[model samples]
Target: MSLLADNGKTSNCRPAFVCLLLFSLLQLPRPQYNLPFSVLALFLCGVVSLSLGQNDKAQRDRLIACLASLILVTALLQAMLGFVQALGLAPQTYGWVLFTPGASDVMGNFGQRNQLAQFLGWGAVSAAYLYATGRMGRAATGSAVLVLALMMSWTGARLPLAYGLGLALLAWFWHRRVPQDETVARMARVLAWSVLALALIQIFNQQIDSVLQAIGLPIHVQSGSDRLLDAGFGARRRIEWSKAWEVFLQHPWFGVGLGGYAWHSAWLEAYGGWPKVPESWLFTHSHNLIFQLLAETGLVGTLLVVGGLLCCLLPYFRRGEQTVDNLLLISIAMMLLGHSMFEYPLWYLPFLLMLVIICTLSPAKGWTVQLSGRFRQVLGVSAGVLALAYAATGILPYRQLIQNFTPRNENTLQASLDNAKRSLKLSELSRNPLWSWEADLGMVNYLQPDGIMRDLQLELAERVARYQPFPTVLIKLSILRALNGQAEPAKQALTMAIANYPDYTPVFQHELARYREPELKPLQEMASKAVKAGAAQGGATEAGRLAAVMTVAAPATRQPIF
Candidate 1:
């Protein structure tokens, strides 16, 4: 393929612009999962529109090949890392291949296996593309098989591995049934040899455990087993699914609204408590994508999501163009389907991006060519706006990192520290923040001293009081005060929490235990003295004096102070 055709102009930048806009929208909150389809759709629209302006067969081939190669390389690297981790190597900090520990297992480190599966699916497609283009050899095919095997086993992501193996077997069976062209027949033989080599490696490897220990590493254990036991043979997911069905029954047309499932789930849990209801009744997710979509977006929104998927997949399937791109799209769709059986795959960014890339490569129908001069101008403006937005969002994490890492001794560090602390605090207040309040509270205790931490605790208590109906926040505030050695305040906060949530006996017991610690004696003595003084001045009633005395005296009878 030629780099550029004679008539094809390089000046048309609409495709790049559209991609930028779509990327920005994907970064938005609540409906973040829809970003991939949005990005892919916008990009494809650009590509199709651009293709209308000129004809350049070589350039088109080159562009497709380049994109295919990029996708292949990314997949290869991710697979390699997954394999290395599976072999019991700790994830490398500085390497071409990167793996992060997830969920106390290889799969957990990556947050979800769907992304890795999508990557492998794309890699398989890339390999298939090479074979279709008569570029794959026996050696290349063998290497690809080995890599795929490693990815599947090491990552502990069952879905992608299963899908890839199934597809390969189906392809082998189909190729055997149909009389293949000599070239395709040759490629198939090479693929067969590669599979044979992978089998040999597996045979020699013995136990997966022996291999890990031989390399001075311990075996990776997944939390899924424990979660399964806790959930009663996947009954937790079944419960969530049942609730989603009820939601669908209630709002069969338009969903309650985007991000509304968590709110609705409280009622569901109140009625059907199969899974042990969490102290704080928060919906992790619908756990089923289709159900989640139905519950969140309703029927009309579900249709849009379904339509987007069809628009992304139908083109390549109809054309019978089993190019690397088409394979990626199919694999991603399958992977999503698999992941949706257990997890809400759209929550993560990388998986979402994989979906977009796959959809972008899929063929579309009835793509009208309405590229007028004015429309082109709008495209340029939109692209510029998107570019700026992407830049801003990309920089936020870095800014936060800098603020978080600033030295405490520096004059300006206090302000930065305050900001970081406030960010954590605000996230706690929002209730639906990205992280758990326990985690945020831990950060505050670890980073700040006792005096400043006490002030923050007081502020948090006040904030929780304002949102009095929400007992979880109040419980957390009480815990924070208890940890900071503020017995009186902690008791007051716990009293409020117990009143709001009388059924939460464990929380009350936990706070009472903290009051009985010996380390709290100094504070208790001070509180007791203040109470007696107030009583003498007739400032405190008999009940108030008794409450104050109980707060101070209870710990003295339990344990000796250090």
Candidate 2:
């Protein structure tokens, strides 16, 4: 279907939009605390309105420009911050911004350096498109590319740096394609500036890095080898993706329900004979977008998501003159695709929203038909009322969960649980791995250890495992399993726990040491070796590449990190 706006009546627009909304809505926004569902809803509404031809061509172009500018500005500011950090001028972030910083990295406005890199990549490309088209000035646009590229380099964000350079080189070819009536000299000038900017960006890491070292200037917080990077058996993301694949295999048809990525990882760590994470950087979604889609939504859901994206994108590939907007969309699409391959860019509301806007912005045939007259009045009123109700009721639990952290008073504690339960309902019967898991942890904390109900403990244990493979919770589960007389399962659980953690708690060590189960001794040894094997596989001299090595240790621990 033609995607550009026109005077027209369209039926397909409704279905494609509905599918887009479905794919987005099922994602469950609470997992990313910074990207709440309300934000997604609002952005969805705007995209739908535009798609339904509520806005004209002029308005559409303006919106696109505005969005590009917004992305560029945010990236520019982030790069500026990174430069300052590189110069050892920025302050360290200890507390939470979104995902609490575990180490000193140039995280920019984002809590993670990787996320900021994703945004910087988009910004660099956007600037390139604007400069090549002469829609924006060479100096300003060139500086943006230079600064963002430099930041991406310094932060060790390899993909963004690579993407920026690749696209900058591609932009050179576009310079000859510009209309002669327009400033051709302008294209050449911008091309030269961009090349210079990219070159500087490429060397910023090595040159400035050496300088910082030689001067011995105290840098802003140094995140010496990160916990998420250091704590996992292999590369953290590979292990997380492997767990996601395992989840898909178990429930290949319908999958393990929506918003279930973290839970599956928890289960993998628990029953799969891998130990739980001690750190907070939980893999809430599969780092690989396709794998996450398959694990969370199953086959049908994955199909729907893929189909919906095609519906939006296929229209753009048709022959058309290379316009500024087209270039911008192409650049944005590549960057988004790059991040989604190895990062959860779709979970970031702003990125998703930007994508929806970009993918939907194209010319269409026929007369634009907007809802109007008395029918429009009724429709508008109904939409407002439903929006208000949803905002008030559906989001109430998310708000409560964010506000109420930990509570000791019985009423307050119950209220928090109630809120989380309510959130689960609004979350399409799913739980936010981070916040929802916190509520569950709080519940376990409040229960009396001696009098805790076995069934309730088991239920909580299973649910917690689904969300996060927290060692404390898993230990508690194993203890409960033992108390309930599930001797074999309990032994297996303890073995896996020991396998995961090289340095476990004293309580866990004592319990394992004291266990008399002769059957479990071999299993414990297998689990231990599995952990060591994963470490050895990741121990190769190569820097940062996830090794394709898989050990022949016990199946429980030998699964390749995806």
- Tell me the TM-score of each prediction against the true structure: 0.59, 0.69
lDDT of 1 at 163: 56
Using lDDT, give the best candidate's number.
2
What tens-digit string does per-residue lDDT give for candidate 2 at 190-291? 535644665564554445556667788544332212122444434557767777878888878657655567656644654564423322334577678878
For the record, the alpha-carbon RMSD of candidate 2 to the native fold, in angstroms, is 7.8
lDDT of 1 by residue, 101-207 (tens): 46224542354465565556556555655665666665675577567655544444445434545455644643554444454455445445444543443333336
Best prediction by TM-score: 2
Query: Which 10 consecutive positions of candidate 1 have the poorest summed lDDT?
Result: 553-562
What lDDT is reached at residue 292 by model 1? 83
Candidate 1 Cα errors over 4 Å, as ranges:
1-63, 83-104, 107-109, 169-208, 215-233, 273-283, 319-328, 373-381, 384-389, 392-562
In model 2, what lDDT does residue 238 have? 70
